[model samples]
Target chain A: MPAGEICIIVPCYNEQENIKNVIDDIIDNTPSKEKWTVLVVNDCSIDSTGFEANSTGKADVLDLPCNLGIGGAVQAGLKYAARYNYDYAVKFDGDGQHLAKNIETFIQELKSDKADVVVGSRFCTKHNGFKSTFMRQVGIKYFQWLIKLLTGKTFTDSTSGFRAYNKKALKFMSKHYPAFDYPEPEEIILLNKNKFRIMEIPCEMRKRQGGVSCLSSNRAVYYMIKVSFAILMAAARKPEE
Target chain B: MSAIQIISITGSLFFILAIIQAIRLKRLKEAYALLWLITGFIFLVISCWQGAIDIIADLFGIVYAPAILFLFMLVSAIIVLFQYSIILSKQNDQIKNLTQELALLKNKAQGCSKDLPNKES
Candidate 1:
């Protein structure tokens, strides 16, 4: 078992249909003896996501006053972890796409101390999983190439939401996290530029259980352009000592 | 002065006075009001002198003197608007931080209250 307190930060925006099941899956899969807390950040969901998570009686729920989008919600979770002094924090999507079994794998990777952050990549292995739409896959590929060009680092799943971070990484990330506009690829550039060790592990993912994706087909061009500019800016940013 | 100069001078004076009054009433911060005050003063000078715009346009090799004034106003507007955008972006970040902090603090408070043993029990 991995030692030290771990926080599973689940940022949910109107995931009422799958939030409970996602939280339950995490609780059921992870070890019972180890110190781990599941934090559900409800980003002012119109649905009863907050109430459902609270009723579970097994997760800590933070009800944001207004919608801060995914970036703000995830940052809030990391801020909570940093304030409470947690050893590790893992970002798990609340739409039930991420697997709970991989949470242990992330903790184990962090324990080995080789990497400061671990990204769960679906394309890292040959395992059969929900590979996303063709258009999105093309977008992800473009981002992967762009990141490589800017940071000289190759990430198979550049936009993977399933990620884990240690104390140092989590504290640093909470402060600089960007808004909901394709922040994952930009984050890779940020982490790489800052000299943080980022590792990617193969993990299987399912299709999102409920709710529509924030990124729509119409906005794909805008998303790509915006995210590319953001990645370039992140690359040019000065690293904190 | 021509009739048009009289009208222009009156407008500039009114603009300057309005900015001053807003500053006096604390409706506008002095730092931000300074630009408007300076622009109004420039307008008053150009209107009163009449030849000042012609001189400026000639210096810039502009064929049309009135076009120079329009260009000047456009540039000033852009600069002022750009500065406001910067301030707005900063305020936006601050608001985001505050919201996150409020949520976290509320959660902590609830946890603390829940931990307290029931007095009635």
Candidate 2:
């Protein structure tokens, strides 16, 4: 096959304050002129996230009629990538935590033909960026332990949303990804069951440029328990193949 | 009539009338209306023939029969709720798909409207 299309999927929910800068950053940092398309999924924001995204005209805005959470928003973008038959689909947060500068690294890594899904990890290297608070770090470690116990594979930063997916991964997620809550850790179990390869690339993550994170201190605990059950349920069932 | 009898009779009649009204006004789909009708019919029969509850409860080896009647009603309600949960899950999947499709179509249309592909130099 020849060179393929790369679609950077930005799932936005009330990120009007940071969305324009996010789009501009991606456009400024991308190496290719027309190969990469910034597809932003505005998740029915009550604010002007949709308007800001559309006004920039640099990204293709997919305005959802109803809010479907992060999974639905991201999956909507994935479905678009699958429909248009893009070779690579990358998920970047709309709150500006994810930097566009590392996208070239992701593309280069995907080109290396190693992992079907490439996770941009904040804990992969000593020179990491903004490694959250102490409690959040402990929560990350707990998930790391749980994943190792269940799948016998170690994954740091299981909840990080900055990641890249090739066509095969994008297609799979477009059809069967969970549409309710956070799907990062759940996706690991799914990929493990289905026998897909995942690789991690070191990424520099920053604090959010604007808006509040969905996971609070209290909500983080609930997130861990909920994701644990979801992982267990997924692992308990046999793979469809 | 006893207090329990009056309550059961009134409850069952209310359910039946509610189902009928919902179907008549097109508030409930015919398929779903059938489920409500079945529940109301079961309640009506149990209220009218109280001995039937004893026989069924005795068959299940429970000494307290009326307790079983309430338990049965609870189970039926739970099953209906489970059915609705399944329906909601399916509808959720469909809505996600439709939203994704609509977004893609809208984007493509915008692109086309901006510049007709064939007209490009």
Candidate 3:
């Protein structure tokens, strides 16, 4: 965001082959590599993901003893950002899908105070990158419509993890995040309820270079139903004071 | 007495023995075992002296005495489960806090390692 410290969090599981590539890409593409540091939350990977990330000597690796899933791992990273007094935090996937070149663009938006959170969207204008399967596209449309109906905010890619958070959002999420299922979907509701401004811009994403998507095969239906129900339930519940 | 009374008394007695064994083995905490101990005692008393429950049930306008026993059991089980749920929620919060702390500690440790002067240079 500003000229202050920024932490790029990479929450990965079983992604040993791609973690080094991710670190190199970030260092090569970040506008100011000196201002940014990479923090890899290893999410209790069963493989050598932690060792690979650590051996890179470019990113710090946090190896969790138990698998806390993607949301829990990312929250741990946020807490790290807050503890280190980082001015901004960005969530970058470790599967080599997210482009590090977009870091500058996200920083520009945050510096300009465009929004409290800047999300890298594949559908902000045109889907120029790797679009999900047709079924996933349908699921994305479902979330987009549901979010608009509930919070009156429109979103194209509701599940994109490539996002940047200002200090306020980072600090708040470091402690209080959606602890239940569907972290990304429930996050939209939580942010809206807490009055955090979220904006998305068009960005390109490559297909995973290593591991498979968690929602690759048959879990898509379950994810869609779970997130849809979670969004509706969040709308019904009163915002926590 | 009757075979039903004898069976119920022996069954409750065996349950009490099993619970004590579990507590002794450290499989169950004393705080949690207290409820089961009370439940076992209630069962032993009612099964031995069926009339006690009959009188208690009469006071509560419960026609069927054994039905009152089941109701009490159901209510107690729900309360116990709710207590465990509360404990679980607190543990979950603690786990999240510990995770955050561990990550921060690791980051600091890494920083220290990098800051160390190279000996081979």
Candidate 4:
């Protein structure tokens, strides 16, 4: 792939109702580039997500045989992009939380060589729409503090899945991404350890267009414990020079 | 032997036995087993000759004997974490490379389909 080629990766579990609309929005928003492509990694979706994604001419459907969690699914997409030699890769949420309009900003940042990874942060700037619940806000803040302590960088929205990565970042993440849920914090630490530059771009997120969030009240506690342990373990380890 | 010596010897023997069992069951890898074995031997030696450890601890500028043990535990944890990170990063690289190769092969196969005959029945 050339220097400016970008691939958008969307990981879907059971977004049958929203998959088609998401794909259409992505297609409508993507600029005319010879090498730009959309890769929808279907994480063994029991719904018609795979069928709907295949129907969309804009995306390349990569269906996993078994359900890997969101982390695994995103890793799969990164692997595809890296293997294809794309210059940049962006991860977009399958549930429509990420807006297609913000993709241009990500591309512009990458093109200008501002940072290796550009993250779309909801809390970085004031927006009138879609405030996360108070509990969720607290959870995000705790993770953000942990990330800052571990990585020495303050990230406003550590859990936001909307982000773009340059080729080197893509290669690094593809090689060493977390396998379970809530990989964002761990990935940020890993990237920082490797001396990768990460920048936050302000973007608005919409409510989900389809199925409910995978993170329930019970799962939130589990996520906190697991992520905290993972971060501590990661912090203890020495990074390769 | 005095009562204190007898109790220390018995405790050291029990610790050594547990370490051996762990090694046998493969719960402890060889590198880790070496550390455990060394620590167990040190305990066994101290239990047999407490005066020797006292002299060494004094020479090392250590007042409390347990401080050495705590230091060893902290160092071992750090080493284990370092080794684990190496393994995890290597595994991640392999997974990424494999997935990328699979995607490329799929893309190549799709491209080749156009060159083949339409039907071969």
- lDDT, candidate 3, B1-121, per-residue tens: 9999999999999999999999999999998888889888988999988899889998999887789878988987997888799889888878866876776676566566552111110
Query: Which is the better candidate, 1 or 2, if ranked by TM-score?
Result: 1
Candidates sorted on TM-score, descending: 1, 2, 3, 4
What is the two-chain DockQ of model 3? 0.25
Residue pairs with colliding backbones in model 1 are none
Q: Between prediction 3 and prediction 4, which has the larger TM-score? A: 3
| Model 4 clashing residue pairs (backbone) | A175-B92
What is the Cα-based TM-score of model 4?
0.70
lDDT tens digits, residue span B1-121, model 1? 7999999999999999999999999999999988888889989999999889989989989998899789979988998898899989888788789989999988887765432111110
For model 4, how does the per-residue alpha-carbon lDDT over B1-121 read when each residue is reduced to its tens digit? Answer: 9998899899889988998998899998777567667767777887798787668778899999767667755886687677789878877656654554564466446533332111111
lDDT of 4 by residue, A137-171 (tens): 99899989988887778999888999999998999
Model 4 chain A: lowest-lDDT 10 consecutive positions: A1-10
TM-score of chain A of 2: 0.95
Model 2 over residues B33-99: C-alpha lDDT tens digits? 7777888999999888888988998799988888887797798888888889988998988887788
DockQ of each: 0.38, 0.34, 0.25, 0.06
lDDT at B45 for candidate 3?
A: 92
TM-score per candidate, chains pooled: 0.94, 0.89, 0.83, 0.70
Worst ten in a row by lDDT for model 2 chain A: A1-10
Quote the positional error of residue A106 for candidate 3 in Å. 1.5
lDDT of 2 by residue, A1-241 (tens): 1123888999999998999999999888988644777888999999999999888867778888888899999999888888778889999999999999988888777778888888988998889867589988998898899989998998987888998888888899888786779899888888878887888888889998889788888897788789889988988988764
Question: Which of the numbered candidates is closest to the native, going by highest DockQ?
Answer: 1
Residue A191 CA displacement from its true place in model 3, Å: 1.2
For residues A1-241, write the lDDT of model 3, one tens digit per residue.
Answer: 1123788999998998899999899888877544767889998899999999888777777787777778888898888788778889999998999999999889788879988888888888764967577877877888888899888889887788898999999998887776544578778787888888998988999988978666656777678778788778877887666
| Residue A97 lDDT in candidate 3 | 91
Give the 10-residue window scoring lowest on summed lDDT in candidate 1 chain B. Answer: B112-121
Give RMSD to native, each candidate: 3.5, 3.4, 4.4, 6.9
Reference-based TM-score, model 3: 0.83
